[model samples]
Target: MSQRQRLWQRLTEAGIAPGCHQALLDTGRLQPNTLKLSHWVQAETALWLDGQLLPSVPPRRYWAYHKPVGIDCNVRPDDPQSIAALLQQLPPGVFAVGRLDKDSCGLLLLSNDGPFAQRLLHPTQQHQKTYRVDVDKTVTETMLQQLRLGMRYQAGASWIEARPCLATLSAPNQLELTLTEGKNRQIRYMCKQLGLKVTLLQRTHIGQLYLPALSAGQLLELQPQQVILAAQQP
Candidate 1:
């Protein structure tokens, strides 16, 4: 294992926010200049800045939450409707892996492992995410084919191309779609382009991670291996 990482990067990996570190330095609680490059952290070294001892790196945690509609994914301490409000008991630096828009709900991952989250969310990873959608009108074979073929739409100054890995009509008005790329409200926009109104949208899967039968507002701690396996899935 490498014993060297930039001070800010090390703090971030250990679940400390960069802003907090800067604040400590600014307040004279930390003296970065006093530490030499050779003083980089090793596995057994305890971290100290100035006269204050920093806590050891917290154990990395992973969680699966059945995010409910109306809960914003963004972390806003002052907003009761935000995901942060629901995760008050979580460790200080754990954050939602990606996002579930306020109008959509279902499986969401929260973790303190930044690299793991990146592997799952980055577009180049091509991780699969499945959604069960309910539209205002009946979904036909033609519409399914169209969705599979992909669509392009202009959003403000940019054009977005959205295509599903799989698109099938689960019911007269329900569709099960799997996508490898996530764009902001892509499903709703795609449906709208086809003259369909979306009534409900719930994400059921991310890579190999499935939403268990947890009720809305329920959260479950997940093994880190489970997350790793999910991201490794083809």
Candidate 2:
């Protein structure tokens, strides 16, 4: 194994959230004076924080869950209908990377590694999210072109353009759309603006990771590499 890597990179690779690691260093708990960014992480090297030797990073966990409708992505302990309440078996520390509204259902990635989540969800990354949508009426070519080119929406005091990388009529009343941005209910909003009613909105892919053949409300643990690889795909 290559033994040369920056401290932050090592921490991220070890499944430590970059922000969390920096917090410890900033608080004088990580002994920044003794450690340098150029320091290498080795099997025999010990990491100390707050005078206590830190253990090797815990094994990273990743899961692809088929979020069922009615399950809120950001689950609060007080919300009985949240994903946390519906799926009580998720390992502690794991959280949904992004969100699926209470009415939408499909693939949702969960992970304990904050850096990994950041990489996938950061707006700058522009990871693609694909959805299969069913509308109340037949979608026209003009509407598809409008979606592909872009559409404007009111944002408080301003208007913002929302565009899809790919939009096609999967069926007379169904559409397959891929987007790189995550705005608030973007797909639904886009459809509403186009004078269409969305009857069903299901996310089928996030980057290259697809919703496996799992039943609604089901969870499947995946190797961390699977997600990383998917995000790297075109």
Candidate 3:
């Protein structure tokens, strides 16, 4: 499909009117920033008001939220401290791809389209995510060795994917890890079994994308191709 066609499909999937997509094409003003492609698509998606279709306005789009520690990823109905509180300052319908545990913080992708979010977060794709972790004690050779061979841990049930890799060891107690799976507290559980207590865990990369220098609570819009790159990753 042509770029315009793909844009149309995304817009339709996002609940934007077909005419609105055409209108955007007619105006020819869509240009995505470097943040990633999903943001580009979300920005181009048409907005709706009441029952009338709004003209293709550069939709308020994808944001790479540098989520700080201690915030829920989901929009809550009553929690004022949730990420939802921060996002509510923007337009409605914005949602997160995957999730960050309240205590875990790092790069998070948020968008307005449900389908676009699904393509990135779906586990079957096995998109690789890199994280920087800080444990309470120094990492040992034996613990590192065990992590190389996939270790099973109980998290409601026994689970294992591939063993995680040590990306970069900043200090005796600080290290970086990369894994393809995003099971609930997967890294923390793995560390616990090996006599490590996690002090901090922040995801820094997902697929070909990185968080760059975006600060806590700050957000950047993604270019359309960036989103496509992740979607096409194995």
Q: TM-scores of the models, in the given order?
A: 0.83, 0.76, 0.70
In terms of lDDT, the best-performing candidate is: 1
What is residue 202's positional error in candidate 1, in angstroms? 0.4
Indicate whether candidate 2 or candidate 3 has the larger TM-score: 2
Q: Candidate 1: what lDDT?
A: 0.78
What is the overall TM-score of model 2 with all chains considered together? 0.76
lDDT against the true structure, each candidate: 0.78, 0.77, 0.68
Instruction: Write the residue-wise lDDT of candidate 2 on 75-150 in tens digits.
Output: 6767888876743465445668899988999999887665677778888888889999999999999999889888
Which candidate has the top score in TM-score?
A: 1
Better of 1 and 3 by TM-score: 1
Superposed Cα deviation of residue 160, candidate 1 (Å) = 1.3
For model 2, the run of ten residues with the poorest summed lDDT: 2-11
Off by over 4 Å in 3: 2-60, 156-168, 225-234
For model 1, name the residue pairs that clash. Answer: none
Error of 3 at 189 (Å): 1.0
Ranking by lDDT, best first?
1, 2, 3
Worst 10 residues of 3 by lDDT: 29-38
For each candidate, C-alpha RMSD in Å? 3.7, 4.7, 9.0
